[model samples]
Target: MPKNSIKQDENINNISNKDLLIRLFSYLKPYKLRVFLILILLIYVMLCGLLNPYLMKIAIDKYISSKNLQGLILLAIAMFILNFLSMIASKTSIQMLSKVTNKILLKIRQQLYEHIQKLSFSFFDNRPVGKILARVIGDVNSLQELFSTSLTSFIPEILTLICVTFIMFYMNFVLALMAIIVIPFLSITLFSIETISRKRWQNYRRKRSNLNAYTHEDFSGIKIIQGFSEEEKTSRSFLVLTKDMMDSFVKAVRLNDSFWPIVTLSSGVGTILVFFYGISLLKSNRITIGTMVAFIAYISMFWRPIINISNFYNTLITNFAAGERIFEILDIKPDITTIKNDIMPKITGTVEFKDLTFSYNNDATILNKLNFKIYPGETVALVGPTGSGKTTIVNLISRFYDPTKGSVLIDNINIKYVNLESLRSQMGIMLQDTFLFSSTIMENIRYGKLDATDEEVIAASKSANAHAFIMNLENSYNTEVNERGSRLSVGQRQLISFARALLANPRILILDEATSNIDTHTEKLVQSGIQKLLTGRTSFVIAHRLSTIRNADRIMVIDKGNIAESGTHKELMKLKGLYYDLFMSQYKFLD
Candidate 1:
């Protein structure tokens, strides 16, 4: 298993249920009027339902037993009208609730997506993309039932329970007491079951997240699995994750399924007790037959609400686990955030690292007490062995990561105090692995400057030597590039990336092995275009090919996180230092 897989299994601390619920329901505040109207409609529906049983009691005592046909027909018609109105109210309330719930869901999903975008890159570094997707798409979806049913079903049931209890006592206190005798025992059982089920639900959600993460990773790397002939092994591993998720779901459902039986048994016991006691009351002439029948009807009505409430509790417990998972991400404080009064000045592109020391997770230093300055419009080439902090230096200048100690400055301004958007917007970076979105060639190039005109986009492409190939495509600049530009060759992708960078017209440009993947012939073709793009911009180039940096104004050989040599290429060749050794190693064949 990969190291990230192990990290995924680590336990997540859940917030208290009370706090989670408070925060979750806050999303409903915006639709208060709609919720209020739904509540009123639901109350009316419950009242209409309650009236039917009383009408039945009246028919039995005043009309059926007495054989009064006129009275019976009148009561039957009334019952029908009441039932019809109840149906209308129920339907209307549900429709309204659905609209409100869906709108709230849209807002929640939007907020989550925007928050994820603002989060620092470090957050993404440790989490799987699939796991994040599960939170935004799956976890948010789990709350749909809660939203739709809470106002229409759950709240109405609570009101029903209260109303039934009061009406039962008013009719006959002794019979009402008998009907509710088993409630305390039922409540205890439910509370105990809920305690056990909450943990099981948490486990189920965690396992589901893991399964999603695994599936996403496997599909993303399907090409590698085929290349290595490890399809069977990968399939077995996925099965293990799937099986774990299934087991957890089954265990949670088993506990949830127990709830209905307990409620049913309790209701049965209450009804039996009420029946025998009511018969005794009637026999002793303490209550009329009509009252006895009404008591029985109330007993049935009473337990129905209890059953609905119990089911709502079950739904709450399950979705509470999902809610906890979602809020955890929302609670994370981004490592990088802009100050309220941050500056957005136009950059002159003079970058300086002042007494900088940095580490990842405070493990080992990658750059130590580094100090360097590049004047505006100077092109500096960096050559270093792998892991010698070549990329780290450029990353610092771009403000991707803050130094553990000291500061990085741009145009005599501390980057930490500058608006992140303003700082990054003025800089263009093209890495060895060029990433192009699944979009048309023109749109992908225009991504650097969203408002760039079509003519400007075409001009930029021509400057990067990409216009000729783009014109040959079936749709010219309109041709679609598949995900990450997989449809284009390596050289074509790099040139498009260059076009994108050139279109940005940034003051600072960093190229990290931008031509590393291109063939020799392709590199020769792009070399002039690259020089033209870097002519008036401050540039940092990390190149392994010594020939590419021969004309660089200055070349710095970085070793062990420090500059081992710095001078023009010809000046460094006479020094016989690290730069000389690296150059000789690459072009020794020519000698």
Candidate 2:
């Protein structure tokens, strides 16, 4: 990865609000009917708002002015009925909007998940899980306010403004024109403030995501930090990030605060203009007293929707920014994808890498023209110094990445032309660090093969030498493993992982330095289990310890991403190459 990509913060402003809105609205395509129905309800609600001032005018001019008590009672009842009907429509619209919004959110989340799953290992290697999660869950959630509140409120508020403006103009054109003049200035001020606030808020969102990433990394690696007595340093680092996040958030809130007061003062000015100007018309007897009173109500009513329109625009911008973040993840096309015509091929577990050149980036190579083959039922050990591309080789075999040049073949079929699931399903891999999900021990073991029976699980566990220790626990297979299996000791976790691989019953097995961190006793137990497990499968073992691979059918010493030496222990020792020197250096320790 380049240094530019290595930085945690990437420029997120590449996609604009309009582009995000277009994408988000596309997701809403499926729920179009529900959205339309919600809009209709909103329109009805706005109609009710327009009718209220008119109804009050009727009560004042017809009932009160004529001194007809019965007319007053009837008008009051009519007003109550309109409000009741509006309330029902409002409630129904909210409920429907909530349901549709949730569905849209679910679709976005599912697409994000599928995209992430399809991404190459290199993408994950470069991006943090916390950052991906922020895009999927946190940023997607920010759109809820947009869909639920903004959608229903915005449409009706806009329609209400138009309707009220029309009604005011019809009642008295000059007064309505004068009252509306403040709109342009108010809009300009609100929009300017909203733009600044939204930018600040976007920064706040980025910082919040970074904070989440730091917190997740800290907690996940807490054991290591505590063991090395670096807790205080980690805590201080976290506090600094937290403080920065809080400061950004405060800046956004302060920006929002400055604008609300201005809008309020502007609305107050518009109201004073309407009242003072209308009373002069009343004194001149140019309009009825009731008309003046109704005009005042309309003035109050009209400005609210205008203010709401400004508020909605502010909300829309913030949500659009969040939507852009979410779409950025959704837009990531995987670098490596299975060939459309790929199909599973019959295999005898004979693996071959033919002139494979690989790189994490286009500029530099990690493995250069690597050529190797493992015969059926053979256990091959790869020994290399750090950064010698040992792990890269295993990654190639699994097709977690495709080679930049040449091919990796299994049973004479290029792995690239094989179904990814089929290729991966036929192999079992246990990395040095085993990860277990939050579930029972049995469930974790069964995760290797979702449909594996209890008897099979026990048999596989026994083969991995994990059954005895598990039975010693209070709940045995029923014992709960917390997130990442943190409750289990390192050896115990390895034992369970081994059992999982065994239950998978793969034709090819990969043990990537499995015993690198376990205690000596546990290593012996795991090594013994591995010996039993490798009986009928082609196995590749990457190890630092010479003893672990000494008895292998073949061992290859890798140097600088190329094979420097290869042979059985005895043959390699006789030849006295890189393997011979490495083995001799540790021969006495094993003894």
Candidate 3:
């Protein structure tokens, strides 16, 4: 089970039904003009429904009793016209509700997506992509019925109930009391059921999210499962999650399904009680037979809305479960924000860390209160053992994360005060694992600079040494990259990413294991091009392969959250320290 859940974070008992309803209905305010029109149409339809029972009463008391066939015909015609108009209004109201519900859902989804985009990387580090997707896709979809029935079913049925109840009391108050005698008991039973049902349904939603998250994770790592011959292991894991989801679903639905039966039983009891009481009133000549007949008709009309309202209450609870999750996501404030940030102007390529310190989720410090400076046009290389804060350094420079204690400065201006977009826009970063979108090679390269000309793209590709292979393809630059560039080799994909960064023409470039995926032959092919691209730019190259950074102006060997060694390749080799040990181990088997 996932550690995250609503109950764990919030005591839902604190959120009253009124507050939830108020918040949910606030979404309706945007389309209030249309909603008002819909309500008017629904009221018309409800009034038509309320009239039918009285018309039958009139037929019994006046028109049919006199054997006045023409009067009866006129009454029937009037009832038919009323029913026809009601049907048209009902249909029109439903159509309007659909459009309104869909628009509100779209607005909600857009807000969720935009908020998620603004959140800092640390927020994502603790959550799975699949869990996030479940809220965005499945949880958001659950609110559709709440919106649809709010206008189409809930409001109309409620109004009909009110009108029908009032008419029954007006016709005969004593019998009206007798007819609804079972209601208090029914309401008490429903209140108990709803409280328990809400919690169960919330559990089911959580289980379903867990199941979805596991399925997505399994599929994403299908290759690893197959490579290790762990298909049966994965299958067992999937079955466990599926069974958990099924159990919770069955429990929740079983409780929810009992609602209708309970409602039917209560309605049956109410009708029987009314039938007996109406007989007493008729026998005593307290009410006319037509009025007795209309009372029974009104009883059915009244109880039917109660049944519908009970069902709507079930829908409301289910939607509340979904709404809680959606609101939880929307309620999150982005940890890192561009608020009150100053836009960074173009600068010389000098970068410095000033007493910088950071930790992931506030774990053990990855970077201590260290300080360093790289001058304009310097080609610096960072070499370290695994988990030596190499990536964190570049990430800080790009403003992906704020330092815990101090700041990173570009040209002596603290990046903490700089707008993230403006800060990152000046740097080119190529990560170890490259990702390509579904588009043609040309478009993927042009992504670096949306308005770059074809000539510029071609020039960048040539400088990155990607032009040769791209041109050899059947469709050349027009060839599709496919999903994550699966159709292309690792070297080809990395080369395309190289071209993308090159096209950006950034003043400060950081290549973090950019050539790790490429074979030695492919690495050699791009070595000269890499040097050319690095020329006159402040560059940070993080590589495990010592040979790649042999010509760097300086190499910093990071160790235990601090720089252990810093010098040219020869200087580090002469020191015979940690850098010397790492350099020897990498090439010991080569020669």
By TM-score, highest first, what's the ranking?
A: 1, 3, 2
Minimal lDDT window, size 10, model 3? 5-14
| TM-score winner | 1
lDDT per residue for candidate 3 within 1-591, as digits (tens), equals 113531122222335678778877898898989999999999998898889879999998998888989999999999999999999998998899899999999988888899889988776766677778988999889999988877777888988888888888898888888878889999999999999998887888777777777788788787799999999987887788788879988999899998999899989888888888888878889898888878888898998889888888999877788888777777777777765599889968999998888887778999998799999999999999899999999888887788888888789898777788887888888988798999999999998888999999999999888898999999999999888898899889999999999999899999989888778887887888899989988999999988899999999999988999999999999999999999998889677
Each prediction's RMSD over C-alphas, in Å, is 2.0, 2.2, 2.4
368-487 per-residue lDDT for model 1 (tens digits): 898889988899999989998999899888877888999998888888888888888999989777999999999999998999999999999988889989999999999999888888
Off by over 4 Å in 3: 1-16
Per-residue CA lDDT of model 2 for 351-379, tens digit only, reads 99999998887757888998988999999
Best by lDDT: 1
Query: What is the Å distance of residue 225 in model 3 from its true position?
Result: 2.0
Better of 1 and 2 by lDDT: 1
Model 1 clash pairs? none
Weakest lDDT window of 10 consecutive positions for candidate 1: 1-10
TM-score of each: 0.96, 0.94, 0.95
